[model samples]
Target: MKVYKGIGVSPGIAIGKVYVYSHKYVNARPEKISSVKAELKKFEAALKTSKRQIKKLSAKISRHLKKEDSKIIAIQMHFLEDEVFVEKVTRAINGGKSAVESVREVLQEYEEMLLKSEDEYFKDRSLDIKDVGYRIISNILGIKNELEFIDKDVILVANDLTPSDTALLDKSKVLGIVTDSGGLTSHTAILARALGIPAIIGLKDFSLNVREGDEVIIDSENATVILNPDDTTKAYYLGKKQEYEDRKKEILALKDIKAITRDGVSVTIDANIGAPEEVTKAIEYGAEGIGLFRTEFLYINRFELPSEEEQFEAYSYVVKAMKGKPVVIRTFDIGGDKDFPYLGLKKESNPYLGMRGLRFSLANIPMFITQLKAILRASAYGPVSILFPMVSDVKEVIKSKDILQQVKDELIQERRDFDKDVKIGIMIEVPSTALTVENFIGIADFFSIGTNDLTQYTLAVDRSNENVADYYIPLHPSVIKLIGMVQEVAKKNGKKLSLCGELAAFKEGIPVLLKQGIRVYSMSPASIPEVKKYIREITLEGKNIPDGFHQGEVDGGL
Candidate 1:
């Protein structure tokens, strides 16, 4: 028996035969063409065909999956629509290169640069380019490309499944996924989680070791894969699979129940989402409200800025859907790992410490005002609060509030219908902000602790870097103390405080945070069920609230 290990992105188990799926590798040989005009025309036609196929597939997938999942295909369409990509390919073709060769050469260069980066975000983006490049070349060559056919229950193994390739998968037939190249943030991993499929990615060359119809046992709970398991091992895994399924069912049973402690402490469970479509899943999972609606999705993966009308429509859709539940829309945290080319941002040696979050929005006054106006307009529909990310100074909070008031005055002059008393909040992600929370109690309405960035900045470790990933500990004594300090200050001031980050969903960290006086926890929608179950199991009998603060009084504001 052979055993392989990889990162388990989606949690589950599957004991089945192997289904070795493969994509037709397109090799564009360096062919020299005589007619530049003819080659350019052929390239343009191929691009159009590829785009149409993507749109059709996107429409088809939206009918079955969440609209956010269908967005994977829409992002691919952006690749075809990007002017920089088209111009580079066109320039290469005009220099006497064949359409197919120009596409392969240009995309290969782009992919290579991204692959060389340490960031997994860049690596995932390269896969999209690779997927789009493959389709364009195949269309140019007249090679009929179709999704892999799965006939029965099997562990689907591949080199790497692209976002589009994973979207076309038959979720019912594929018991599990094992990919040779992928991380937790990869598009395939994201789709697998959305589909509730068991996935183990980054198993380099595991496909080469297995043959079609070979018995495979995927233990995603432990990130283990066993090939040709013996009877004893099979029996052990069969029992394990049953336990995992039972645990899932038990956790899901808490969907309708409130996330309250056994000792009579109440904590609000909310979901963080990138787009309005994800609000449906959040509600299905029993999210009390939308904690962090990342507004950057509207700006990223596109060639131009999203107009005010576009932003207003999206914010309104989410706000109305929540039906009066408090929705905290974080104004575009764009920079650091999430960068847009249209912003014309300079390349910084250290992007995390560079102009990001509130700094970026403040510097670009026009863009910030447009987003502020859209958010304020949407507040008329339901309870909406504007959240500023990566805030460190007291002055930043005052400056932002000033701009918000200015926008409100402008809307009033235009006779626009909007909520005049919209709540203003700031994220306490920086160490400096957490340490000085007392100063902001009178300035901001509420505070949310972004533990992801707090841990990174405090520990001086890049969470994305694999070399020092072990040092990125969120539960370190110093970090936990910072969280406790912020909770204490917020509670003393009677300002509602929520914790939104990966740390919020952590089962081991939740009890500690509750003991530290945090009352609101926000996490990914998928994690809501499990986290609620864990919270229901927790009891803080001996834990006393600091300063005799009433627990019921904290759940009042945004």
Candidate 2:
């Protein structure tokens, strides 16, 4: 058996035959056309066909997704009809270029203009634009758009997957995913997590080393893939798979039960979700509430900021879906290595420490006010909490709350409805904030430690950088100590403290967190079962858990 290690962004286990995926794209050469009218007509036809296909595809996707989540497809379709892009193609064709050639050149030029940014997010947008370009150009050229060789129940091995490619995936047949490139924050990783598929990315040589029909074991827990395993090796992984399923069964049995120890101490068990569709999965997995609703999904990869109604619609969907359970919606945490080109955010050398999170929002007051107003409107539906990210001090929190108040005032003047008493919170991620938690006690309603950024900021380690990924340890003693401090402060002030990061989802780290007096664990939807199972196990045994965790008889039930 051959083994490959990758970054496990999504958790699960899959034992299946490998189905390697390859993309066949046609590069359009600059072809001079004899008739500008003919070429323009061809371009128009391609645009029409692309729109038809996009709408058809959007309808298909909407069947599996909510309207709020399917808006990206609509946005892509609108981009196809954007007059600026179409005019560029028209001018190129009028200059004696074929329709395909015009599309290829104009889109390439547009994409290249954005690709010049050093920021990763803008670079990512360039890929998205390129995807849109390919969709239209390929429609014009009559090239097959979907992955051609997908077979049922097969683990897909690919060099890398683009957003367009990920969007077109056949969910039923594609049992698991393995990609050679992409980090934990990559678009592919986010989509994989949303799909709840077992995925391991950043395996640079995986596709090259594996062949089709190879029996593969995807142990995403350990980020290892076993290729062409012999009987003994296969048996080991098969047993692991069974154990995983059994544990899931046991955890699901407790899904209806409150997330509490046998001693009857309750802790909030929530799911951190990126999209509206994940809310159903979170609820199915017994998530009491959404700990983190990353609002960036509604804001990214576009040339315009989302409107107040659009933001309200997205938030209201999640807020309403939770059915009165408290949903914590995070403000736009972009910048800090993430970018929104539409905002005209200038390129910065060190984006991580630059205008990001509350700072960026503070600078863009109009956008900030728009989001705050939308969130407030959504809060009227059910219990909602607003969280600000990358808060270094009380001033940012005070300022944000002030703007929120202004929005509320405007809403009141306009005689609009809103939750006047919505809870306000800040991420206790920075070291200074962790130490100075008391200063923020009265001003904020709660504190949620974003361990991913906390670890990154605390240790000065770029967690997304693969070369130094090993250094970005969530289990580091220093990280645990900082969390312990935050927990102490939260407890002292009678404020609820929740952890919503990669650490909370980690099986091993759960015990560590539980021991640190941290009770709330918010993770990905798929992680709820295992993390809950581990909590149950330790608390049942009265083993490493805190005092009063085990109060009743333990069972070897499942």
CA shift of 411, model 2, Å? 3.6
Candidate 2 weakest lDDT stretch, 10 residues: 549-558
Q: What is the C-alpha lDDT of each candidate?
A: 0.83, 0.78
lDDT of 2 by residue, 479-520 (tens): 899999889888988998899887776656766787688888
Candidate 1 scores a C-alpha RMSD against the true structure in Å of 5.1
List candidate 2 segments past 4 Å from native. 16-18, 25-38, 66-69, 118-122, 145-153, 162-172, 183-197, 209-215, 540-558
Runs of candidate 1 with Cα error greater than 4 angstroms are 1-4, 27-52, 78-99, 109-119, 140-147, 542-558
| lDDT value, residue 86 of candidate 2 | 93
Clashes of each: 0, 0
